[model samples]
Target: MQEKAVVYINSDDSGRGFLGAGGSQALETFVDEIAQNVIDPQANVSVFDRAKAHELVDASSAKAKKEILERKGSRLEALGSGSDFSSFLQHLGIPTLNVGYGGEDGGGEYHSIYDSYDDYVRFKDPGFKYGVTLAQTTGHAVLRMADADLLPFDFRSLYKTLDKYAKEVSELAEKMRENTEMDNQLIKSNDYAIAADPTKHEQLPVAKAEVPKLDFSALKTALDSLKKSADKLALSWTAASATDADKDKLNKLLFHAEQQLLSAEGLPRRPWYRHTIYAPGFYTGYGVKTLPGIREAIEQRNFTEAQQQIGVVAGSIMQLATYLAKPL
Candidate 1:
């Protein structure tokens, strides 16, 4: 089996966008590099085209050109469980890509008998334009992977994305604390009873304990270290002096980087799904829960568990940084 790259083209007719795909760290970068370079023939533009336009439009006139020039190629969604790429990415730690096209086609015939070829042709892509487009897009991606001298894996992007998730989890904890405090205060003051009319019966909210402060120092420190290490790795990889053996060793390390983010014990009550950074929400099912271990624990108001998970996730981040910092 080829260790270079893996691409999966899944049907996406939800009208959200062209396609939303993701994978483990190395795979995520591999797919994104291909998507950014491959031009969308139908639109007569690169897949990165719209993102550039959006950035330019959002920026001030003076900075617009600069923003467009510096902007990275195609955006990638975080990979959650519940897709064909799950086993290849989450289990085997292979570089995998799940691709598809959508955003102009919308329908409600999913999983029904009406979801036939005729229905698709009539309601989805008439004349099969999108089908051909998807073929072209994924085909180009496959060719690029097959031909590239070094596997394209962007550790910088991964570090930035993970850093964002860490911030989000910290913010989530603070927000939960604030909300809990507000609720407790409202109950203590009997505001609910005061707001109710004498003629109508009302049940007052029960008084609850205030949420305790969470320690995010460890997580923050780990994320900072990870970012520095990632920056160094990215620089080293892009250097002209780097050799093929160096690239190969770096790629191998990246391939297993995502594994460090997984815990043997898994998220609370969800042992089968082991990704700490991204996982399918237990209640939302298909929806993604970033920093799942910490986010879900806080969501359920399990402060003790949340604190424990925070340390666990911090350790994982530190481990990943160590791997990247190791000499190639």
Candidate 2:
């Protein structure tokens, strides 16, 4: 029996290669590393490296090219809720992988009664070569997971991704402040009435409250502390003297680390979905809400709720950092 396991999933009905959702950074890195390393057999190059080279040639602008080239690997888009991995990752906090191949298929008959073998072979994966590719790619992932002495849970990438999300929410608040100020100014000046045609009677728009300044310093400080702790943990795990017991302890820590991101109270209205970092948007269905508690509060113009959520998220990060900082 395998000491650890890697589940390989292929959402045949799903369109395109690896439409990942939930803990996307971790899963994307996992899949991308495997895809990039496994030779395409026919193409004679790693799938990821080939894709990267093509992107460089097809890039339209110097800035775009630079950004593409600077990227360490293929960009893994954030997961929303359209696949089977949602339950395992978001609900159970399991480190799972969702894999598939697409981009060549037109998906003309997707989810329809007419979607059959003829449709698949005719439009999607004409030679069934991509099907083989998917198996080989995921096979490599399973082998790596099963055979490796230590699991590959890259906290550095996770920290980097989370840091990016933090900056985005902070900037979102700042941008809202500016927009609200401008709207208030226009309302005060009766700009709408002034701009209205003389023939038509246009009602003045109601004024909204001034956007309050949000304090994200706590969140920022917590993130910094977490990054430092992640770096230290990475070093300790990779150290030459790390024993089997030490590795086992580290693995357990890694498993529970993601669970710490969950809030006991959950989001403002949604208690079932507990992940503080990622959740499906309340209104957008499948759309992802990064830092949902804070992002949604700000989006709805609820500063009080936003402030409360900030503290909650910050506390979670601090707790995780403290756990990671514990001596091995």
Candidate 3:
């Protein structure tokens, strides 16, 4: 094992206890807190830190790159070199910390000459101030993670994501209905806007078009029920952490909670992916689909199907809520 370096864990973990048990109030609190307090980019932006590292060898000579490389006793570059900490941290699910300093050096040196030490010292860590900053940030992370009483995962973020997806699916259903209604009226009226105002008028499309009204009452009721369940679970879990009865209830609900969110038939087009919280949209690759059943149903202009899907999603939500409401 290489020398261990320290790192900070700044993530919020309010949802761990509720992971399988369903939605917990703690998870909601986590999301709320994050939205309220944003992390500073200079201080917390890990992605930027990673990107800045490449400057360590930019526009410089091989001599400089090699010098820094040798001094640091680290490779200037490693192909297929899975960074030591990444593979295990990311793949094995072990938390990881990647530490490095660079960015002042604009010295670029591809596998060629022109790469020399002449440029690195003058450019890369000019005063090495940022290097110190990096160290401080790293130390902060290590201390936070090591000292925390619990894992740092945020449940509120998860809930926010879910809420946004639900609204999106509902909106899709509305839009599809409107378009279909417009198409029907277009054929019935035989009045193309072109014919009505052939002079290229820019007034705007006519209004008062009636689209199918989706019955979200079922969904609302389901959510309300689930919220109640979540509250119940929080009360029970908080009051009796050591009770087997509470744990048993939570464990039983865990299986039902997440499972209830999935449709045996899967999304309308993509049957391979399941799971309500995380799924690939049929049209959007690499993008997540939330409340997909209803969303996809609307996209396909299937009102009856869309309406049915709302019930399905809502039922899942309620199931999860009930699970969370359990004693544990």
Best candidate, TM-score-wise?
Answer: 2
Shift in Å, residue 248, candidate 3: 9.5
State model 3's lDDT: 0.46
Whole-model lDDT per candidate: 0.70, 0.72, 0.46
**Per-residue lDDT of 293 in model 1:** 82
Badly placed stretches (over 4 Å) of model 3 are 1-164, 193-212, 237-260
- TM-scores for all candidates? 0.85, 0.87, 0.48
Cα deviation at 213, candidate 1, in Å, is 0.8
The reply for model 2, stretches above 4 Å from the true place, is 1-29, 40-43, 53-61, 104-108, 198-204, 240-246
Clashes of each: 0, 3, 31
* Residues 22-115 of candidate 3: C-alpha lDDT, one tens digit per residue: 1222233322222223322344543322332343435288786566545421211111112343232222222233344433323456234754
Deviating ranges (above 4 Å) for candidate 1: 1-17, 25-32, 51-70, 197-200, 240-247
Candidates in order: C-alpha RMSD to true structure: 3.8, 3.3, 15.0
Question: TM-score for model 2?
Answer: 0.87
